[model samples]
Structures are given as C-alpha cells and as structure tokens.
Target: MVVVGGGQAGLAAGYHLRRQGLDFAVLDADPAPGGSWQHMWDSLHLFSPPEHSSLPGRLMPVQPGETYPDAGHVVDYLSDYEKRYDLPVQHGTRVDAVRRDGDSLVVEADTGTWRARAVISATGRWSRPFLPAVPGRSVFTGRQLHTVNYRCPADFADQRVIVVGGGNSGAQIAADLALDGNVDVTWVTQRPPRFLADDIDGRALFDVANARRRALEDGRSDTGGVASLGDIVAVPPVRAARDAGLLYAKPMFARLTADGVRWVDGSQSGADAVIWCTGFRPALAHLVPLNLRGPRGHIPTDGTRALSEPRLHLLGYGDWTGPASATLIGVGRPARDAAREIAQLR
Candidate 1:
C-alpha cells in the first residue's frame, strides 16, 4: 500500500503500516517527513503543548516551561521518528493522482508511479490554505497574502495589516503582531470560531469535536457539513484570542479596494498585509476509484473497517475524533486502529 502526503498523519500511518508488516510505502511531497510542521511560519508554536503533541512511540523533547513548541521543534521530532522507527518514507516524492487499475492501485507522481493493493490517503485539509473571497482582492496595493505563505512575523514588525479568519492561526498571528510585531494589525472574521482549552492537546477544533466524534463512532459521516474550527469546539484559539484583546466582528468584510479592505460598515481600513487563517480542505480529488465520503467533503471511515476502497484507508482527517482527532495528541489513536485494519487486509 502507499500513503500520500508526508505530514503528521502520514508519518504516523507509515509507522503503523510498517508495524503491520503490510509492505507499504509512504509518499510525501517534502524533502523529509515533519509534514506541515515544516511549512508553518516561524514564531508559530503548538498550542497543545509538548506533552500532548508527541507522535506515536516517539516522545517530544522537553521544552522549558513552554507547553507548546515551534515548527523547528516539531521538525526535529519528525526526524527522530524516522530514525527511531526506521520508517521507509520516500522524501520529495509528490503524488499527483491515485486511481485503481483492475488488480491494484496506481499512484502517479512527477517522479514516478507506485502500485499497491490498497492506498492510504493522508493528505489533510490544512495542506492547502483557503482564502475567503473578497471584492477587491486584486486591488490591495500593499503586500496581501495568506497565512500559508507566511514564513515569519519579521516582515510585519512595522506595518498595518488586516487578518481574516477566526481560526487558531489567525488568533496567534494577531497576538504575536500585537505584542511582538513592530506594526498595528486589525483582525477580521467572517464568523466566530470556537476554541478548546490549551490543555486537551492537539491543533484546532473545539466543542464541535465532540459532535464529530459521535458522528464517526456511529458510522454516520458528514461531520455536520464541515464547519469552521470554532464550530467544532472552543479551543485555545478562542481563549487565547480573547485574552489578547485582539478579536473582532465576523462577516464584516466588504471587498478589497486599491486603498485597502472596505468594511461592511462603509468604512475603509488600510492594510499593509492580510492573513487568512480560514482552515483547510481534504485533498481526495486524486482518489478516483474510491466511492467514499459523506455529505461533507470527508471520507467515511470509522475506528475500523477501512471500506473506502477495496484496500484503501484515510488518516489525519481533521476532527475525526472530535477535538483531538487531528491534533498531535490525537493522531496516534487512529494510527493504532488503522494499523490493525491494515493487518486484517493482509
């Protein structure tokens, strides 16, 4: 079998696939594992803290007093996971498509093609950042970009900005800028997202996680139509954002004019930058032969019974277990379960 996307979920899945003796291969687009942890902007750290953010069979090194860690720290841990488990993941191999061809599943990438009896799709929603549609997106005169494109806050140290989205990333960016940035930034939201306590351990998804967990457990997919991170549960993003006094109205944007963003109130806000923390979408378009998924764009895989394809499974799906499913703390749970399922296929 082949696992696509080398992020956290993919790495965990690859580790388990090896344990199951399933003759599987992990296909990741990056030069090494570390997943999205490698892509996050600097100064970004895990809200789940070190204790909760650890991977399967791998313990994250202790950080001084800090509960959460930064992207660099996470990358280091992923490297260690590979070394400890000796996971055979093909680095820098991007999977362009996954389709079934009679007897086996064929994975196509610019580098090469891989055939397998089953395929595990781990490309998560966060792999791609979603920017909200605005009226004058092209009119913005200053630098306008998404959180995905952000590498660090140094650029915003002395500028005026507008941040969109009510997710954790938005909140964190606002807090960092307000405190450390050398500039003033305004954060806007289309809707208020919920946040979980920094204690539960994982990434985003708040109260809504409970609801999602119930849905998956019941084998009833649809995740209530894949709402925002806050819709899932109230997590650190909400708590931390409120604590920072940098919150704002939802759905208050009008459009982007050459000057800046036009607010719903007919006021103009000049922004040197705009950040979208709007969350992510699943990358399952390549899984052509799989007749899976519920009403929401999520695959229908419960704790077990990988029924998406004859030999297919999906891992690292957000909020599969409610708040914890997609978090670093929660990924191992599904990885363990999926490992057993893969064994059954053998």
Candidate 2:
C-alpha cells in the first residue's frame, strides 16, 4: 500500500495504517509530511479546540483553560508527530499519475514508479485555490489576492480595500483591517455563512457532545448559531464581531469594475485591493480514471470507507457524510477505518 500526501488527514491514515502493520509508504509533495497545513494562510488556526485536533493515541499540547490552539501550534505539533511516529514518508514525491494496470495499482511520481495493491489518497480538499470569475478581474489596477495568498495586511495599509466572501476568513480579515486604523475596508459578501460554536470553558466535553447530538438528531442546519453551547471554549468570533460592532452586512456582489466593484444594491466603491475568501476547490487530478467526483468537483465516495476503487482509497479529501469528510477532527475515524479495510485487503 502507498499513501499519498502528508497533511493531517493523510498522516492520520498513515498512523492507523502503521498500527495495522501494513507494508506501506507515505508520499507527499511537500518536503515533509505536513502538507496543506504547512501552506495555510498565517493568521489561521484550527477552529476546533486543541484537544479536538489530536490524532488517535496522541494528545495536542493543552492545559485546562488554556484556550484554543492557533495555527503555529497545530503546524508545530503535526511536524513533531511525524517525527515521533517515524512514518516511512518520502518527501517531495509529487504523485503525477495513479492507475490500475490489470491487478496491480501503479503510481508514477517525480521520484519514480511504485506498484501496490491499494492506494490511500490523503491529499486534502484545499489543494486547488478557488477564485470566482468576477468582471474586471483582469483589469484590476491595484492588486487582487485570495485568502490562500493573503498573509498580512502589510501592503494594503491606508488603501481602499473590498473583501469578498462571508466566511470566517473574510469576516475576520475585514475586521482586522478595519481595526488596523489605516486601511479603509469595505466587505462585500454574497451570503453570510452560518457559524457554529463547538466548545465552552469549565464544562464537560460530553455535555457539549450531547448538545451536538441532539442538534443532529433534531435535524438542525449549519446556518444558525448553535442554540446549545456546552463543550465550546468560546462563542464564535462572528458573534463576537457583532458584539464588538465590527461587521457591516450587505447584499451580494454583482460583479467587478475596472475602478473597483459594484454590489447588488447598485452601490459602487473604489477598491485598491480585492481579497477573495470564497473557499476552496477539491482537485483529484492525479486519480486514475477519475473514479468518482461530485458535480462540484469533489471526490464522491461512500464517506467512511475511503475506497473509491476496490483496493484504491482516497483519504483527507472531502466526500459524502462520513468521519473523513471535512473538519480536522473528522479524519481519524475514517482514516483508521480505511486502514483496517486496507489491511484486510493486504
């Protein structure tokens, strides 16, 4: 077996695969095992709490009442976890193609070719940057950046900036720029995302877990703030932004103009820079025969199984409802389950 890409999801699968005693090697395009986590924007962190970010059998550094861990902590921990596990990982081995040649699965990479009976795809969903096609994008005079490329506001100080998207990134970045006391930030979002709270301090994690279960059992949607807050450490930053008077809600964007942008409300503004926090795209470009992908270009699998092909599985990347679909915490169950499945195959 061969595992591809070494992000959290990939590494989770590798960890379980290790315990399964499978003869497998993990390959990643990055120089190390931490793949996409190593490439995220600097000002980000796991929205989930630190304890939730742990892999199976490993605990992330946390003390009671310490607050949620940030991006640096998550990155540093994943880097260290890879070292302690000593996973047989080949860095800089960008998998170019994966196909089934008769009974054997073939993997072609920058390093060389390898064959296995099964393959685990753990490359993650955010591999491809998604940018919506807005009018005048090509004609923008100042600068345009995706949240994927945005690190800091160093260059946009004192400039008229219009940020697009209503995710946590867009909301928070606009608020940050506004708080910077130099840049004039205008936030234009098509729709505000529904935020959810996952934890609260001084409460039992199980209490919070029960509330979530009730919400799920009651068929609650992701569009509203959770009515029940148990294990969550704090309220969502979006709600906090409202409490702080940092948000200005508006209609969707119609398109962009050479001078700036025009919103659905027939309002026009001069934007020096446009930052798109519009979210990510899942690209399984290297998959053989492109087994199954949904209409939106995500791998459409049966969720937890991870096997898009009989002996071929895809990890990390988002799929239908199962343990391995989206959140960092969602990876372990599916990764380990998939590992067990792959072990049986071997």
Candidate 3:
C-alpha cells in the first residue's frame, strides 16, 4: 500500500499501518519530513493541548508549562515521530496520479512509480486555500493576500487592513494586528462569531464531535449536545483582544470596490489591504485518475474508504473523509480504520 502525504494525517495512517505490520510506504512531496505544517504562519498554534493533538501510538511532547504547541513545535514533533517509528517515508516524492492497472494501482510520482494493491490519499486541505469570488476583487488597488501567504501582522504596520472570515485564523490575526495597534484592522464575518469560553476549548469540542460521530455511526439517537466545533476557542491572545475591545467583527460587505468594500446598506470602508482567512478546499488532484471525487472536490467515503473506489481511500481531507478527520487529534481514528482495512486485504 501507499500513502500520499506526510503530515499529521499521513503520519497517523503510517502509524496504524506499521502497527498492522503492513508493507507500505508514505510518499511526501515535501523536501523535509514536516508537510504543510512547515509552511504555516510562524505564530500559528494548536487550539488543543499536546495530549489532544498527537498522532496515534505517541503523544506530542509538550514543552514545560506550555499549553499549546506552535507551528514550529508541531514540525519538530512530526520530524521526531517519523524517526521514532522508523516509518518508510520517501521524502521529496510528489505523486502525480493514481491510476488503476490490472488488480493493483499505479502511483505515478515525480521520483518513480509504485504499483500497490491499494492507495490512501491524505493530501489534506492546506495546500489549496479557498478564495471567494467577490465583485471588483481583481480591481482593488490594495494588496490582497490569503491566509496561506500571511506570515505576521508586523508586515502591515500602520495600514488599514480588512481581516475576513470568522474562524480562528481571522480572530488570531486580528488579535495580533490589534495587540500593539500596529495596524488599523477591521474584522469581517458572514455571521455572528460564537466564541467558546476558555474553560470549554477545542479539546472539549473535539471530544464532543467524536462522541457524536460514534453515536450516529452506531445508529443511536444521541447528539452529544454539540452540533459543531467550528467556532473560535478563546485562546489567550484572542481573549485579550476581546477584553481590549479590538475583537469587533462586522457582517461581510456586499462587494469589493476599487479602493475598499461596500456594504449592502450603502456603507463603505476604505482599506489598504485585505487578508482572506476563508479556509480551504481539499487538495485531491492526484486522485483524478480514480474518478472518485464528488462535489467540493471530496471523495465520498464509507469511513475512510472511498465509496466509489474501494481500493482508493482518502484520509484527513475533512469530515467528508472521516468525522473531524481534518484536525491533528481527530485524524488518528480514521487513519487507523483505513490502515486496518487495507492490512486485512494483504
């Protein structure tokens, strides 16, 4: 078997495959062990603790007195994890396509080809950031950047900036920008933001989401009192921003203008730049040869195994691949299941 991706999701799948003693290799396109995580903004940190954000078979080692691991910390952990497990990871190998060849599948990559009995595509979503099509977006005179390219708030000092999206990225970036009044920042959200209190953070929400998923899977009529964990968790920076009255979020404007954005009520705000944190779509172009993708570029799956192509499973894209499977903590379950099923065939 072959796993395409070396990030948390792929590592989780590798962990499970190793436990099953399956002959498999994880092919990562990255030059180093850390996948997309190495490319995230420097200040990004996990909302959950190290204990809740670990891959299967190992706990992410936490620094003394640290609650959350930053992006660099995670990269180090993943690097150490690959070494610790002795996982067969072929670095710098970019998979171009996965096509059917007789009873086996052919994994065509930049390095070489591998004919495997099954394939698991865990390319993840970070590589494909989603940017909404807004009118006059192209005509805006100001600089525009997606969250994928945003590094730090220090770059936009004294500039009028519009931070778009209601997720943690927007909130965190807004907080960073507002911390020292470095930038004049305006936050925009499609709806009112629901901030989870500090006491009830992402760890609790992850637990609830998993429990809810299990209940539904078992055909039990239990909701577990949580519909979604997509809201913002009140991390220290975000909390401070809220306390300082800098976390104000307004509804999204109707359209973009040449110099600014216009609201539905004829209101407009001039801005020097826009930071879009609107999230991402799954990166699954490599699986086009399998013809397993559906709406939203997702491969419909039964758990982690693709419904249309049973031999072609997808991991860590999102809930469509597996319940809460996009998160560092949530991916282990689905990865384990997918590996086990593939092992059974061997």
Candidate 4:
C-alpha cells in the first residue's frame, strides 16, 4: 500500500494502516514533516481547541495560554506524531504520477517507482492555490499575492492593502492586518460575510457535519452542516476585529486597475498591495495518468474509492470524499475507513 502525502490526512492514514498491520509507505514531497502547515501565515491558527484538532489515536498537546493552536504548534505536533508512530514515511519523495501496472497501481515519484496493491492519494489542496481570473488582474501593477505567499502582517506595514475573499483566510488576514495598526486595509467579498456565532467552533461544526451525515445515511431529510450556520468561524482575532468595527467588507471589485481596484459601485481605491485569500482546489494532477477525472475536474468516488479505479482512493479532498475530511479533526474517520477497506481487499 502507498499513501501520497504526509500532511494530516497522510499521517492519519498511516496511523490506521499501522493498526491494520499493513505494509505501506507514505511518500511526502516535503523534505521534512509538518506538511503544508509549515507554509501557512505566521498568525494562522486552528479554529478548534487542541483536543478537537488532533489526528487519530493522538491528541495534539495543549499550547499554554492559547485558546486555539497556532500553525507552528500544529507543525510541531505533526513532526512529533510522525516520530511517535514511526510510520514509514519517506520524506522528500515527490510523487509525479500514478498509473495502472498490471493489476496493481504504480506510484511514480521523483525518488523512484513503487508498485502497490492500493494507493491512497491524500495530497491535500494547499499546493494548488486558486486564483480567480478577475478582469484586469494581469495589468495590476501593484504587488499582488495569494494566501500561499503571505507570511506576516509586518510584510505589508504602512501599505494600503486590499484583501479579497470572504472565507476564513480573508477574515483572518484582514484581522491580522487591522490589529497591526500599521497597514491601511480594505476587505472585499463577493457577498456579505457570514460569521458563525461566538460559541460555535470546529467542534460544533464537526458535530453538525456528523449529524447531517447520519441523517443522509438514515434516508431522512438532509440536515445542513456548517453552511447552515455560517461561512466563517468567529475566531478570537476575527471576533475582536468585528467588535472593533475593523473588519467591514466592501463588495467585490469590478476589476483591477493599474494602481488599485474599481469597486462594483464604480468607486476606486488605490492600494499598494492586494492579498487574495481565495481558496484552493484539490491537488490531483498526479492522478491524471489514471484518466478518471470527471467533467468537473474531480474524480467520481464512492466514499474515498475512485469510481473508475477501485484500486485508487482519494482521501482528504473535501466533503465529497468524506464530511469535513479536509479538516484535522474530521479526516481520521474517513482515513480509518479507507485503511480498513484496503485491508479487506487484501
């Protein structure tokens, strides 16, 4: 067996695979552990408490004086988890493609090729940041960057900045900049931002998702999950900014101008930089050789198993693969199921 990532999803799969007593290798492109968490902005934090933000069989240690663990804490925990479990993860092995070789699957990586009875592609979306093709985006002369490139608020100090996107990333980055008191920040969204209640966090969100899943499984009326609550969770910093009236959002811009953006209302604001907090798509380019992608650019799946290729499992992409599977707390269940199913097949 082979897992094609070493992030939270891959680690979770490794844990369960170990329990199943399966021989497997987790191939990670990164030279070290921590996966994509190491690339997040400095102030980025999990929306859940440490306990709720843990992987399977291991609780993330509590960070003293923190309500939510920061990205650095998560990176450290993942590093330790790898060592603790002694999972067979080959770091720095970049998987280039996956294709059929006889009855088994061939994983072709920069390191080498490996044939396995089953392949679990847990490569999450952080690698493929989504940038919408807004008009005049190519002509914008000012510094423009995606969330993947952003590091800290200090990098944009004293600059007139605009943040695009209404998701958690946009809210968090805008709040971080507003708290800095040095950057002139404007936040714009396609629609009004929807924030969850102060009491609701990732734990509540996961419960809601589970409830919805149960309802669907029982053939009852579909109960909505987090979307029914709101798009963004009111994390500490975001709530603070909201309370202080520093997180107001304008309508998305009509287009990018040379110096800044022209709003939908025909008003223009000049900005020295624009940070796109746009989300990401699944990083599944390596599976193209399998020729299983649907018209929507997603592989059809029954749970995590690819519909066309039963030997391939796609984990931790999104709700389509498993409910909230992209999140740290939500990924374990699907990962466990995938490992078990693979074991059964063997």
Q: In TM-score terms, which candidate is top?
A: 4
* lDDT agreement of model 3 with the native: 0.87
Best by lDDT: 4
Off by over 4 Å in 4: none
**Model 1 spans > 4 angstroms off:** 192-251, 289-294, 302-308, 320-323
Q: Model 4: per-residue lDDT, tens digit, 1-346?
A: 9999999999999999999999999999999899999999999889999999999999999999998999999999999999999999999999999999898999999989999999999999999999999998998999999999999889997899999999999999999999989999999999999999999999999999999989988999978877899889999999999999999998889999999998878888899999999999999999999999895678999999999999888899999889999999999999999999999987
Candidate 3: residue 289 lDDT (0-100): 85
Cand. 1 Cα-lDDT: 0.70
Query: What are the clash counts of all predictions, listed in order?
Result: 20, 8, 0, 0
Per-residue lDDT over 1-346 for candidate 2, one digit per residue giving the tens place of the 0 to 100 score = 8888887877788899989988888888888555666666555555556777687768888734546666667778888788888878888889998888888889889999999988887776666778888776887787888877777666687898888877667776776666666888877777544444434432243334445545665799532222343212333554455566665656666777887877777888788888887887665788846466556675556544433567767666643434323456657777887888878875
Candidate 2: where is the Cα deviation over 4 Å?
63-66, 197-240, 288-291, 304-308, 319-321
**Cα deviation of 29, candidate 4, in Å:** 0.6
lDDT of 3 by residue, 200-279 (tens): 77688787887888898889987843445447888888999999898989999999999999998998899999999999
> Local error of candidate 2 at 346, Å?
2.5
Best of the two (1, 3) by TM-score:
3
Candidate scoring better on TM-score of 2 and 4: 4
TM-score (all chains, Cα) for each model: 0.84, 0.84, 0.96, 0.98
Q: Give residue 264's lDDT in candidate 4 (0 to 100).
A: 79
Please, what are the lDDT tens digits per residue for candidate 1 over residues 1-346? 7888777887888788887877878888888668877888877777555766787877788777666677888898888887788777888888888777888889998799998877777877766666667778777888877787877658877788777777667777766666564768787776655654444444333334556766766899747533533332324444554676755545658898886777778888777778776777777777645657666676666553345565777777765422354666667777777777768765
